[model samples]
Target: MSYREERRADAAAQAEQNRKAAEARAAQEREDRRLELETKLKAKEIAAEQKRRDAEAKAELARKEAEAKRRQELADKKVRAQEKERQAAARRARFGRVAGWLKANPATLFVAFVMVASIVPAVISQVGALSSAKVHVMLAALLAAMLEGGAWAITFMGKQAEDAGRETRKYRIATWLTAAAAAAVNFWHGLEAYAEHPWVAVVLGGSSLFAIYIWDMKTHGSHGKTREERRQEKARKKHLADRRKHHKEIAEEADRLLSALPFESITEEQAFETAWQIKRGTQPGLSAEIFAQVTGARVQLGAAFELGEHVRPELVRAGMLARLYNPLPGRLAEGIPTLGPSVPVPALQQAPEGATALAGIGVYGSEGASEKACEKASESASGNAGGNGSRGRSDEELEALLPKALKIAAELVAEGNQISGAALSKRLGIRRDDARRLRDRVIAERKLKLVEGQADAAVGA
Candidate 1:
């Protein structure tokens, strides 16, 4: 019993041990399989998350690209709109200039209307669209009336302007005659004849209108200025030119007179007395103040009359005043003293050689003439006394007189009067020197030139 029991017990115990070992192995295998499954599941979840992130990045890039495309489209649209506006503005400016030009040229407008109207009727007649002879005649009459009316109106206005003294009556009679002739021709041909020869009527009417235009242009100038205005302008220019020429001549004469003096050989008193004699001979009754002023102007003759280069009138006047008022040291003052008592003058039997030269030089009456001569001179002088005097004239007075003086000068010049400084002095009642200076200033400012042959014509007159 002991041997059998021992063998069985040992086998059972070994079997039990084997069963436990198998159970342990099975649990380990199950745990390893569960771990592998959990690892695979985690790897799949990570891969899905990465795919989601990639899709979101792609969507963001697409959104940015779409926004960029939209902005580009808007910019392009704005550029196109601006270009269109610029083009439209340019077109408007061009049209505006064209309109302004058309407005300024009324003659061109009338011509354009005539051309277009004539063309329309002619085209209709040629196309046989308007077969009515009466219609063509009516159109012809209308065109003829317009042409005749325009011509008549222009002629009537010109005549009225002439009557109003706004224009010279140049071509007024001729213009009326031309207008009447045109009216007569148009009406004499009659409407039915015009319809039969529509083109002939157009030609005749166009020619008459053109003739009127040409006549107007010839008479009134292309700018439509009246003949009187043109004449006045011409006269004004001539006057300024004559004045300039006169001034130049006077300046040259003054230079010549100064050049003839011998200052070095003569004493101051002798030179002064000689100059005074010459001045008195040339311009009798000249006031002491004016003589003093003249002496001051030529003071460059030093203490004696001296030869010098050409000098301006203003400079001469200034020199004379300075010499008389401001004496050098150790020299007698050359101041102009008060006038002596008046003395009876002797009558001259004949005109002096220098009398004519002195005729227009001074504002005072001519001396040493016979009683009758003096009376006659006084009558002529009285009319020009107020005009030719500069004495006591204020600045305002001079300014007020200037326009009228200029107008007279212009008229005189237009009449072929060669206005010398002496003549201007007499006419304006100013000093010869002052006249010279004023003439120069006006000519320069006005940009005038003497007409060719005007001086010869004036001298002859």
Candidate 2:
């Protein structure tokens, strides 16, 4: 019984042990599966967190890009707006200037408007009239322009001439003729178009002429000068012509000056005045040769005055104020002093044999009639003038006049004159002593080639 029971119990224990081992293996496998699942879930969670952070960073970058693009677009728009405003301001300034100019010249604008209006219809009419087989339409269209162009060209020339102070009458006439030609063409066309309504032809013809007349009025009407202005203008023109005609030298020099400037900044008169100062040396209307002659005459007068102081002392005592006294043959009544220093008192009559300083003066001719008269009258007039004499000088006069006489003597000698002893005595009617003494002094001091001969024997010998 124990064996059987023991065997069954052992079997039972073995069975139980097998069952417990199976349960333990199943529990360990289940735990291992649970651990693997948990590890996979944590790994997946980590991956998902990293993807979320990446998505957030991508979204932030996109937002910043959008914000930057928006800011750049706003800046570009602002720049465009500023440029548009500047352009608008420039346009306003330009428009304002144009308005100012239009307002300033209303008459000019009106005239220009009328002229343009007149030309357009005239051109169309001309083209219509001439656009047949012979004339091309383009060439015909240019005909009205040619007519108006000629008139305006003449008008322009007239204006330039008026501004330069030139004659504009011919230009005005030419301008009128040219305008009339244009007006005639227009009238012919107008008449052809409206033969029954002549006023329409008149209007078409007068429009072009009227336009040109207004321009002529503007150019030539306001230049009428008053009397004084006209006088000055006439005088200036005459003076200008005279200067050109009479003063050719100055005009040539002025031409040179004007050429140098090339633009003609200086007036002809101004250039002539400068040239006059250069060429004449003196003021205008005076000559250098005449002035020099006047100067020399004054010098000779001074020399005569200086020499008169050395007359004889006896003559001074005899009521002669000057040392020398030789009154004119008839003017002794005026007092010897009253004859004045300016008169050309003849020297005492010299012997007629040789020439004296006064020779060839034409005052006394070669016949010696005046000399004979002087000597004859002096012989009767001495009264009691001096020893041996008619009217004589003292010996004292000779010594005193020597110093002052040198220059006079030198001048006389330079003039081809020689004052000998007899010539001195005869010229002054002085006592022989003083005449010979003074004459010898002059000859020695001036080194003159004069021979003093026997004086009283030498009269016309």
> Quick one: best lDDT, which candidate?
2
Where is model 2 more than 4 Å wrong at Cα? 1-49, 120-145, 149-174, 185-202, 216-461
Q: Which stretches of candidate 1 lie over 4 Å from their true place?
A: 1-31, 83-87, 104-107, 115-236, 243-461
lDDT for each of the candidates? 0.50, 0.61
- What lDDT score goes with residue 145 in model 1? 57
lDDT score of residue 155 within candidate 1: 74
Model 2: per-residue lDDT, tens digit, 298-341? 34433333232234343224323222342223433222231223
Model 2 earns a TM-score of 0.34
Q: What is the lDDT of residue 376 in candidate 2?
A: 41
**Residue 194 in model 2: shift from native, Å?**
7.6
Candidate 1 structure quality by residue, lDDT tens digits, 1-461? 69899999989999998899888889889888999988999999998999998999999999999999999999999999999999999899899888888888776677556545643443333222222334475565565455455555667678578668786454466565655566345433434356676666555444454555554564356556588998999998886566447444443444455567664565533543444455454232244676566444333232221111122454345445543464331212223322111111211112212212122111112122222332333333322323545354455655666675666556554554332334456678775444444443443333333333455678889
Model 2 / residue 126 / CA error / Å: 6.4
lDDT of 2 at 381: 37
Q: If scored against the real structure, what TM-score would every candidate get?
A: 0.32, 0.34
Give lDDT for model 2: 0.61
